[model samples]
Target: MKSILFYLPTVGSHDQVLKGMSGVNRQNYRNMLWQLTEQARAADELGYWGLSFTEHHFHVEGFEVSNNPIMLGLYLAMQTKEIRVGQMANVLPFHNPLRLAEDLAMLDHMTRGRTFVGIARGFQKRWAEIMGQPFGVGGTLSDAGANDRRNRALFEEHWEILKKAWTTETFSHSGAQWTIPPKGLEFPYDAVRSFGRGLDENGVVQEVGIAPKPYQHPHPPVFQPFSFSEDTFRFCAREGVVPILMNTDDRIVSRLMDLYREEAAAAGHGELRRGERIGVMKDVLVARDADEAHHWAARGGGFVFENWFGPMGFTESLRRVGETGPIGADYRTLVERGLEWVGTPDDINRKIEKLVTQHDPEYLLQCQYSGLIPHDVQMRSLELWATEIAPNWL
Candidate 1:
């Protein structure tokens, strides 16, 4: 299985984050970038498939501080060699499709076909709502809410435009959310006559093209950060976008995989094999022993889930089988649910082996906390995972 390091990108320690400090501190930001670069460099040398960070904003709370993943990815891309760098996603509704299209195309060119893109519907109301105002979208977490529909509308439209920008020579878009070249706007279409293609018979500013088209022919590969819905699965199946499974529940994940395969075949992707073009993400922490693993997990991944994901209602994926009330309410539930693995290297290997045998996923995103988990501990986990566990799958 190919592996991607899904970094949380927090900007400080668990103590600093709990105190609502360090995220906005200039020095911390600087140090975070350098330290992240080192991590990327190491992952590259260690034979990782890719490394991704989330696109978050307004994190004065010292958690989820990755602001613009394209920029952050560009910086990291310049610093590392083999391992691809990109966002687990940039929230689609928050961006202008043209600008995002151009930025990503440039990134693909710079990375020399080493970049990948992830798209999200966005669930954070704090920044997502404010940023999505232009597109008439609101933040949502459910699959069928009004906000969810709006976000998906814009999400699909933006991706359509991005692909067009990369694959089509010159394209014009007239969509519900945006119109290319805008309406009633005059251009230099007639001024220079040297411009290769710009106007139609009616001279209506026919189309606009993004410069520095992607280095990869069709485009850089695309991914969906998380998936749990039928609509999302079908959409990914049709669009050829790989959806990373978010939940570890056997019933849930297995059912979703079956749905994806059926939909892919129905969508003319042919009889896709089990575990083809799919991914699974899990929170993992490997240490010298079970005690050491739990110690760091409690201070890092578990801390974030308890203090942040729990109240934010982002922990449903970790809900225990046939159990309810306060999902992922504590660290113990997190471990019990198998949502995050914290154990010795041998224990981790066993769990990973079981996971692979059960799921057979092509991509495995091993999530290791950053910022809150000390750099040394994170590196050790990476080393152990790459050395002991990764080879089994490879």
Candidate 2:
């Protein structure tokens, strides 16, 4: 299985209690960046397949402070050679499609075609509200019965435009959410002829294409960060994008994979490729003994539940996605449901083997840092995972 190191670039000292949406200290922020760079380099040296970063905004609690994962990817890319760098997801609604296209193309070029793209419609209502997007899932935030379809529509529209921008020499778009080449406005087709040149027979000006095509042919591999909806699974299968499974039971994951394979076959993509088609993310904590591992897991998981999920209203978000079991459950319940793997090296190894055998995922992404887990403890877990567990899969 391919192993990936997933990072949130959390910015707060280990001793600092998570009080929910707290402010960030500049020194801590700098230190976090440096440490993340160091850890990423270590992962690269240790034969990791990729290093993925999360993107979040306006979280003062430092739960997830990597606001610009593309920038972080670039930073890590400069320091490493072998490991692929990517975003766990770039929230679609929060960005300008043209700018994102340009940035992604640039990143692919900068990384020598080692950049990957993950797309999401986003989940946090606060992020949408702050960005002046239509908050909520199905409709505007003010709409009481809103669901996620509206945001999904926006995400689809933006994604279509981005793909066009990347592939077409000159493109124009007229869609529900965006209008490219501005209506009723025109520019000179030829750069040299500034005054008057290259107008259409109807005196209409042509749209200019975005420059610097991506280093990868057509584009880099696109990923869907979390797969929960059947529509999303079909979309990924049809478009050749991989879906990353997150915080779901093994049965659900298997079902989703089966659906994806069926869709791909229907779409004439042929047999699904192994070791490159699907990814699974799990929270992992490895210690010398089960007691130490469980201790830290409980503390970290509680912090994630109370501060991260509770404050961010992610429990409700999960409900919207039809994941109801672990919404309000305690950390132990979550562990039992396979959302977390916490124990000694042998214990984690056994759990990993079972997951791999059952799901047949191509990539295994470990979320090793979260909540109030100290930097030292997190590093130790990484060290143990890389040394003791990762080799078995290889």
Candidate 3:
């Protein structure tokens, strides 16, 4: 079934919005939580399949106000029944694998197996600065590649550990980065043959295991969100990770699918399976009439595009170690890029149809709440889309 997922952003307007790509504001966080809960409850009633939260550390433009996606997921699970809850992603490098395992396990149980985990290597530099760390800044992928390689390795490594922790009776590991202490003398920490799967030095095998066995029988579905990089796509296909394409252009999505399927075929995997979802994130606002949508967007969406996507598209600049610039300096450039799109239900539907036909995505995620948008207008947009647009698309 084609599903709709919503990206909930809970931050107001900001001056240094680009500095922390996904940072959450404290006051805004409280306000958004209530708004988000009401929205999710509505989505459940409306038969939407899932809702997702993005992870961000420090961005001035109000990308993500709340830093804790897992906590949010659990809260949603407790509040709702049918709708699935998840993180659009958690940057693997910024996590402690063991704690992640615990959180995922507890959440899966609480949600009764409605948790989807999207993992990625993050791209924001201002967040790095907040942590007193350094990265190749200003769109420089100098060490990003190496960092990605390490992050991927560690991410997969921890995935194994978490899997082991869930299924095995008393799992023990002595890998390069992790070692689970032995439980006791009576139990040798020998997980069952069907505990879980992991990679050894050689090739793929099903004999290995991870513990506290996932309540979902095998495991919860794991996806890696990517931006259509050939290397990244190939890696995802090879590693049995689902490809969750984000902000991928129409042409790029087609090329990626072909390449991904070809590689999977060459690997003797027959046809690519299970990795069918592609995520298109757009700044969307829907209204009963075009003018209202346009006006609301002109006010709210303009700021979102200018503050959020503007810096990234043009000059992805960040001070090195310790540098400074006027606040909102990049906002004008972002506004110039023309990233915001606002329209009435009909116009919005036309654009969506074009995108859907071009990309043929199995899912479309609407980033409806963005950039300090007013609560009433945002709700109207959601309701209109749910009532007018969604049924037609389905």
Q: How well is each residue in 283-348 modelled by candidate 1, as lDDT tens digits?
A: 888888789889898888788888877787767777546867766458888888887777888898
Candidate 3 to native Cα RMSD, angstroms: 7.4
Q: Each candidate: what lDDT?
A: 0.83, 0.74, 0.60
Give Cα distance to truth, residue 217, candidate 3, Å: 3.1
Best by TM-score: 1
* lDDT-based ranking: 1, 2, 3
| TM values, all candidates | 0.95, 0.88, 0.74
Q: Which is the winner by lDDT between candidate 2 and candidate 3? A: 2
Query: What lDDT tens digits, residue by residue, belong to model 2 across residues 1-394?
Result: 8877777656765456444333377776777777887777777877788888877778777777888999999998999988899988888866788999999999999999999998887767676667734423322321223355567677788889889988987788889877776666655355424543435555465565677889998999888876666778888888888888774655567678888888898999898854348888777788898888887877775456655655544343234235555466467656766767888899988998887777778887777564356666777787888899989887
| RMSD of every prediction | 1.7, 3.6, 7.4
Candidate 1 at residue 108, lDDT? Answer: 89
Candidate 3 local distance difference test against the native? 0.60
Please list the residue runs of candidate 2 whose C-alpha ends up more than 4 Å from where it truly belongs after superposition.
19-22, 134-147, 192-203, 273-276, 310-327
Model 3 poorest ten-residue lDDT run: 132-141
Can you tell me which runs of candidate 1 are displaced by over 4 Å? 188-195, 201-203, 320-325
